[model samples]
Target: MKILFALISTVLAGGVRYIFEVANGLKDKGHDVKIVALAGDHSWFKNLRAEVIYKPLNLNTFSSIVYAFYKFYRYVTLRSAKRNPYDTFLLISSKLGVRPDIIIELAELIRSFDSDVTVATYYLTAFSVWFSQNKNPFYLMQDFPELVEGNEGKLGLNMFYHSLKLPFSFITVSSYAKQLIVENNPTAKVTIAHPGVDLNIFRPRKANSQNQKYYGNIKGV
Candidate 1:
């Protein structure tokens, strides 16, 4: 089967690592897997088996300039109020579907690729997948973003919470995550696909000189 995973950015994060590992594993299993992202730092990950496509948002467009000014105004206001300005505009824009330029750019990128299934790796990407001309959209929910600590305010939390209600099959890492999704949106169809460890990289091994130098005095070596 042909599969595509959509990511907001390929930054150095555990969730992003899991997505890459899953894509690589799927490719090894004879499936055509591709990863699409708005931006990426490819140097962080090496020896990737699947294709990664980066389609960054056009910030030079007239609409984007207007959006940037609006964001700047909001940033100033939030900073004056001593609140986190980051993610505020993006969360609201995504919830209200007001940023046509960003949505359209992302949608066009997804439509450019043909895939039997397209998976959203984050809530923002979920919105993009919903608007895209893609088939079999699935949301891989790593956790409940709304419940995450350090969110600016209730408004931000609400936006994250409401995003979960979008119509898409959900795949999560743990049963607890699935429970959270079902409890919040009872209509949501969720499946638990636990993350796999690469035995080749992570397995029982004896302590070498380097390990002994770091933990030679520890109780368990």
Candidate 2:
């Protein structure tokens, strides 16, 4: 099957890593898999097997020009920041009258693929997937994004909550997440798909005497 995973950004995060692992596994199983994101930065993880398409926000309008200037200001002020700036920039641009343009562009990009199944990895991308031409849309609900701490006053929290109620089949990693999705949207069709660990990388190993000795000295040990 031809599958496409839509993501907000390709940053270094556990959820992003899980998406890459799942996409790679699907590719290894002989399925055509691709990932589409707003920003690209995959240097942290190595040996990515699936293809990635990056379509950053680009609007040729007066508001977009102002947004670009704001981005430049943020870039200069938050140069020492570690998080991806595009994530917040996208949210802020929405209030600047560039959101519709972004949505149209993203939907057009998604339609160009014509994949059999299109999956939204994040709440922001879910909007694009819903509006795209793809008939089969699935949301990979890894967690309760709206309930996450530190996002209380941000626009993303409200958007995340609203995205859950959209008409789409949901796939989650845990039964707890499934319960949350059902509670939030009673009509949601959710399926649990637990993450798997690779035995080659996580198998048992013989204990080292020196390491044991060092750890044994601690009170907890």
Candidate 3:
């Protein structure tokens, strides 16, 4: 199957790492996988199998010009600079030749890719995927974004909560995550797909003497 994973950017983060793992695994299984994002940076992991599409903003375009002004206003008005919005920072960076596109244009770009399955890695991209395609896109719920925002008054909190209400398959990496989604939208079709571990890299360390003694007394090990 042709699979597309949509994310805000390929910046270093736990959620971004999970998306990369999923894309690489899907590619290894002989499926065509592509990562579509607003921008990509080589600060963290790199992709060898899946195609990485980095659609950075083109400032010369009319849409980008308008977006720049809008972002500027948001940056000035926002109480905290940290929450000034990512697109605003992207404008400041202004790296050339990345072929960045606006979020509004994502629907057409995603439709053109003709992917059989689309996975949205965040609430923002979930809306983008929904606008691009009415069905078949999976919302990979990593966590309750509102809690991370730490403020119910934040616009992001509302948007993140509303995204769950959309008619799309919800895929959570753990049962706890699925519970969070169901709590938000009781009618959500949720599924649990646990993440894989690399045994070569991660293994339980031999229990130390204290741990062994405790376990031995408790279970006669």
Candidate 4:
């Protein structure tokens, strides 16, 4: 099975680890997985076994005019590069080749790739792909911030919770959170992945007798 996973929380504390493990498990099952990411969220998983696709374009946040302007600038620059002309860069679903009709554009990019199952735990990250794609979408809902102070921009997260009201099979992180989702959406289905840590990399870090730095500033520090 080919799976497409898209999200913004890959920048969160446990986001990269969760994505990596999920992708790793899927690959172990002999499945092809495609991951779409914005910001620097996918850095840790770039070398992972599954195929990772990135658009390198960020969406706009209604934080302020400056942020909005920066998003526009980046979008236009990406368009000129002839990578995608959705009037914005397609982060995950350029294969869709159509404008994002949903709340967020990046979601559409991911879904456009024509994967069998698309999973998103973040709301707006799931919106675009499920909105445009004709494939089955699986959303893994873990965190929904009530208020984001200095966390990150309100680009995708806020949109998912507010603007998009799409149907999805939700996989919640906790039982309490699952009840909350059902209370909010009676028809929404919830499943838990019972998260765990990978023992392979969780072992103690052995210190080396000698240490080297990549740069002078790093070396001095």
Candidate 5:
């Protein structure tokens, strides 16, 4: 079966790793797999079985105008008002970097490919996929994705939480994550698909006598 995984980035994160692994595993089983990234470090695409498609999104004309005005407002506020720099950046960067229309364009692109199965790896991507009218696209939700601050941050988080109730089925990384989605929408279809670790990379090693003695002493203390 041909499969497509839609994601915003292939950065070095747990969710990104999981998507890569799943794509690789499926490819090994003789299924065609591809990854779609909006914008990310080009180096992150190296050594992947899935074909990486880099699709950079530009703001539409109206959005660009709005963004310019928003930036100007922010600049003026920063100069006149005393605000926490981190919070300010978080508030502005959350939705400004990628607007809803950009995600919609991305979804349209993915749908054009006509894969047998399209998977949305992020809530935003899921929105894109759903809006594209894909029938039963799998949503691989890895986290709650509350990586913002301030009133705008809570709004972003709420948007993500509500997206779980959409028609798309979900595959969560852990039971806890599945429970969270269920709590948001009891009728939501979610499954737990735990990630696997390579034992060779994380295998236990025998401790040296000195190391063992140090641990023993520490335990006693």
Candidate 6:
């Protein structure tokens, strides 16, 4: 199955690395994995088997302007074209070739790729899923979309931004993210997909006398 991991995350951030790990793991299973980066930053995905889709303008701002214009043009054509907006920061950083925007753009490029599962994260990616011709849209809510501002009033407006139009079910990485989402949207159907740390890399240290002696000799000599 073709899996498109729409990434709208910064390089070196945990999110980007997670995408790479998942993509690679999928590829190892002989599945096709493609990365949709709203902003460009090819270096991070260098070793991954996934293909990165890059867009020129930022997904956040460019998408907003596009959404605005799309809203304006909707009545003209008598067609309903609801625009999907992403974060402002992702848009601006896209110019600098940010990885997050690249992921957002990848989701929009849905029409060109045949995908069974479209794991969408960020608002822009969710919009891409909405654009899909026949793909299962899955929203990955990593954090409280509204609590981002730390103000209830702004939270309401931000929620008004796009929460009502949120796609299929949501899979969050943390209780905090899921908690905030559930609070704002009690009826919102969201599932928690707890984030994990690689045991070999993040496990507690175990010191042995022999290893310690080697380290001590290496440090001294």
Clashes of 6: 15
* lDDT of candidate 1 over 1-221, digit per residue (tens): 99999886677888899998889889999999998876656568898899888774555476466656766776687754322222333455556645435455667788888899999887667778888959999999995654442443455456566668888899999988888788778999998989988899999898699777668668454
Models ranked on lDDT: 2, 1, 5, 3, 6, 4
Q: Which candidate has the top score in TM-score?
A: 5
| Regions of candidate 5 where Cα sits further than 4 Å from its true position | 59-92, 95-100, 145-152
Encode model 3's per-residue lDDT on 1-221: one tens digit a residue: 98998877777777788778888888999999998776656346754578888664445577556666775776689843332234554554344322344445555556668888988887778888988973478899886775645632356577788888878899988988887788888999998888778798799998699987898899974
- Candidate 6 deviant stretches above 4 angstroms: 58-108, 145-147, 150-161, 184-189, 206-221
Check candidate 1 and list the clashing pairs.
Answer: none
Stretches of model 2 off by over 4 angstroms after superposition? 61-102, 145-149, 152-154, 203-205, 210-221
- TM-scores, all candidates, are 0.71, 0.76, 0.71, 0.61, 0.77, 0.60
Candidate 3 structure lDDT? 0.73
Per-residue CA lDDT of model 4 for 1-221, tens digit only, reads 88888864355357567767789888989998877765444455545787666554443553245445556776687753332332233343333433234345566567468788888756656666566564787777766555331232454345545522467777776887677677667888778776776678688777654543345457688
Better of 2 and 4 by lDDT: 2
Which pairs clash (backbone N, Cα, C closer than 3 Å) in model 5? none
Task: Point out the worst 10-residue segment of candidate 3 by lDDT.
Answer: 93-102
Count of backbone clashes, every candidate in sequence = 0, 0, 3, 9, 0, 15
> For residues 1-221, what per-residue lDDT tens digits would candidate 6 score against the true structure?
88877765435666667667777888999998887754445575557777777555444665567557756787578776432233334443344433343333554576667788887766555666666644677777654545444433453346434643564667777787777666666777778766677787798787798999999999999
Which scores better on TM-score, 3 or 6?
3
